[model samples]
Target: MSLTIHWTDHLTGIMRRAADPPRLLVACDFDGTLAPIVPTPAEAALLPGMEEVLRSLSTAPGVHLAFVSGRPLEDLKKRVPIAAAGFIGSHGLEMQGHVLDGVPGAAAAWRGRSPFIADAIRRRTEQLPGVFVEEKPLSVAVHYRHACSADAAAVQALLQDTVNGAREFRLQEGHMVTELLPAIGCDKGTALCALADRLGVPRSAVICCGDDLTDETMFTGLPNALSIHIGPGPTAAACRADSPADLLQLLQHVDAARRKNLRKGSCGS
Candidate 1:
C-alpha cells in the first residue's frame, strides 16, 4: 500500500524509506490533534480511536510514544488513561518518564502556588462581563472566547496586567486565551530533546506532530525528524492533515511503511 508523502516533497524521505524503521519516536500534541477541539478545554475528549492507536503504536516494535501537552501531567493521565507512554505536561515544565523533570508529585507542587492567584483571577474576571479564567497547576488561562470583540481586548489587557505581578512566570499567548507559566527554560521542544537524548537516538529518527504555536518548539528540537503539522499554525510546518481522522489515516500509512520495511529487512536477512 502507498503512503502519503507530501512531507517528503519538501524534505528528505529519511523517515519514509528507513532500512529498519529507525527507532520510532513519535510525539504528538493533545488538543485539536489527538482529541477533538471543544469549546471548553475540560470538555475535550480523545477522538474515537486515538487510545487504541496510541496503545498499539507504543507497543509496536521500535516505537516510543509521548503526549506533549500544555495540560498538567496528572490531568493528562486522568483524561487519556494511558500509562505506558511518556508524558510532557505544562509545556514541559513538569514531565515524567523520559521527557520531563522537576515535578515528581505535581499535585503537591501545584498546591503550593498561591490559592490567592486563582481566587483573584476568578473574582476579577467575573466582573469583566465576558471573561473567564481557568486555573491550572503550572499556569492559569484567561479565556476571552465568549467576550465581544470590543470587550476582548480590554479584558485581555486587564488580565495581562494582573498576571504581570507574577514576576516568576511569563505569559503564553494562545487562541482566545493567555496563560501564565513559570519562566523556566523548557518547552515541548525541550521535552522532545530530553527524551531523544535519554533514548540515545539521532534526531532524524523522531517524528513529532502538533497543531499549535507551542508545538513549533517541538519541531525545533527535531530538526532532522519528520515533522507533521496537523492544522493551521503560524509555523513553517505545513498542514499534513485537516482533522483528527486525517491524522489517523496518516499514522496508519506510517505504520504500514514501517511494517513493510520490517518485512523487507527480514527477507534480506
Candidate 2:
C-alpha cells in the first residue's frame, strides 16, 4: 500500500532532520513537482507563488536548491531562471554552467548523434496522427498525448522497436510521452548524488521531491535522503502531497522552520 502522510504532522520532523546537517540540499523535479502537468510541455509554468518561494529558499543560508528534470539544460534555465540554484537537466546527463567530469566530449558527441536519432524516429512516426517529435540537445521526446488510444499504442511499440535495436540510446516512458536519451550511466538519482558531492553536502541532508516514474530513481537511489512524492501512487518516497498547492504548503512550512532556526541562532549569538 502507498504511504499517506499529512504535511502538518510531518513537516516539523522533516524540518528538524533537514536542519541538523551543516548544509541542506533541496532538489525537485520540475514538470510535475513544481509545475502542474499540461497538455503542451512549453505551456507548463511554476504554480503561483512557487517561484518566489524557491527564490527565497535558494537565498537562505546553507540551503542549496536545484531543479532536476528530463528537459534540456537550456530549456530548464529558460523556465526557472534562478541564477543561484543549480539545474540538472537531460535526466542528469547535463548540468547547467558546468561540464560533467569524466564524460569528456560527451556533450559534443550527444549533440552530433541527437539529430540523426530524432530524424529517424520522426520518419518512422510521421504517418501516425497526433504523434510529434520534440527534439532536445541530448534527447528526443515522442509526444503522443493527442493521439487516439490505438495510435498511441502503435507509436509506443514502433518507438520501442526502433530504440531496442539501436546501440547508443534507451527509451523512457512518462505520461503520454516517450523519450530517447543517450545510453549513459546517469539519471536523476546519480545527478542528485553528483550535486550533493559537488556541494559537499551529505546525502542525509538532502530532500528530493518528484511526481513520476523517473523521480523514483532519485527516491530509491538516495536512501538516506527524505523523498516526497507529489501525487497518489505506490512509491519509494517516505511522504506524500496531494497537489501542487499542498506541495507549496509543505515548502512554506520548511521555509518558515529554516527562518526560525536562523533567527534563534542570531538571538543566541
Candidate 3:
C-alpha cells in the first residue's frame, strides 16, 4: 500500500502489454488521473495533448480505451470527447460502452432518489460557505474543496450520518468530496472487469489506472494487470505516477508502442 514500485522502473513490461497479444483493455480514472484535480468540477478538463494521446491509444488496433470516473456519463463525455474511448461513469453505476442489464431493479431505481438526496445535502450544507452539492442521476455528491478545513470535516460527518441512516446508499469519500450511491454490489473494478469480459481481454492484458479510493477498486480488482496510481497516496496499484503529467507521459509511450507494433505488423513478446 505504500507504493514502492514506481511505474518508470517497469516500462518494458508495461509497454509490452500495450503492444502485445490478447488485446489490452486500458481504463483510466478521469479526474486527478487523466486531468489534474481542480478547485471545482466545472473547472476540470483534460490537460494539453492528453486528448490526442488518449485518442491515439484508443484507435490502436490492439488497444481499447475507457474512462472510469465518479462523474456522470454525459459529463465525462463532455469533458473528454474522445471518439474511440468508452466510459464507465458515476463510479460504475452507469457506463457508455457497456450496459449492466443485470443490475438490480432497486439499484436502477436510485436515479429517481438522487434528487431527494441532493436536496437534503444542499439544505444541510447551505450554511457552510463554499460547500456545494452535485446531483447525478444515480448519486449525490457534496463538494467542500472550497470550504475551510473545519467545514470539510463537518461535511464529511454529515455525509457519513446520512449514509449510516440510509441503508440503500453507501458513502464514498474522494479527494474533497463525499458521495452517496446505491450499494448495488457494483464498483469501478467490477464495471471495468465486466467491460473487459465483454471486450474479450484477458486478465493479464487489463491496464487500469486511477488516483482515489474508488479507483482502489480497479487496482485491487485487477492485480495481475499493469495498475498505475497517480499522485501521492498509499495504493494497491502495481506502479506509481507522481502526477497527472507523469501519467500523460506514460500514455504517450504506450501509444507510441502500440503504433510501432502496428507498423511492424507484429506484437511485442
Among all candidates shown, the one with the greatest lDDT: 3
* Candidate 3 structure quality by residue, lDDT tens digits, 1-269: 48448888999988887778747778999999988988788999898889988887877777888999999888998999886767888888877763333333666787688888788888888999999899998889888888999999999988888778878888888988888889888889988888888888787898888999999999888888889989887988889999889999999988898888878988532
Ranking by TM-score: 3, 2, 1
The 10-residue segment with the lowest total lDDT in model 3: 97-106
Q: Give RMSD to native, each candidate.
A: 4.5, 2.4, 2.1
TM-score of predicted model 1? 0.85
Each candidate's number of clashing pairs is 0, 0, 0
Off by over 4 Å in 3: 98-104, 267-269
Give the top-scoring candidate (TM-score): 3
The C-alpha stretches of model 1 lying farther than 4 A from their native spots are: 1-21, 98-111, 163-166, 265-269
| Better candidate by TM-score, 2 or 3 | 3
Candidate 2 on 42-96: residue-level lDDT in tens?
A: 9999999999899888777577888899998888888896888788888888786
Give the Å shift of residue 168 in candidate 2.
1.8
In order, the Cα lDDT scores of the candidates are: 0.71, 0.82, 0.84
TM-score of each: 0.85, 0.93, 0.94
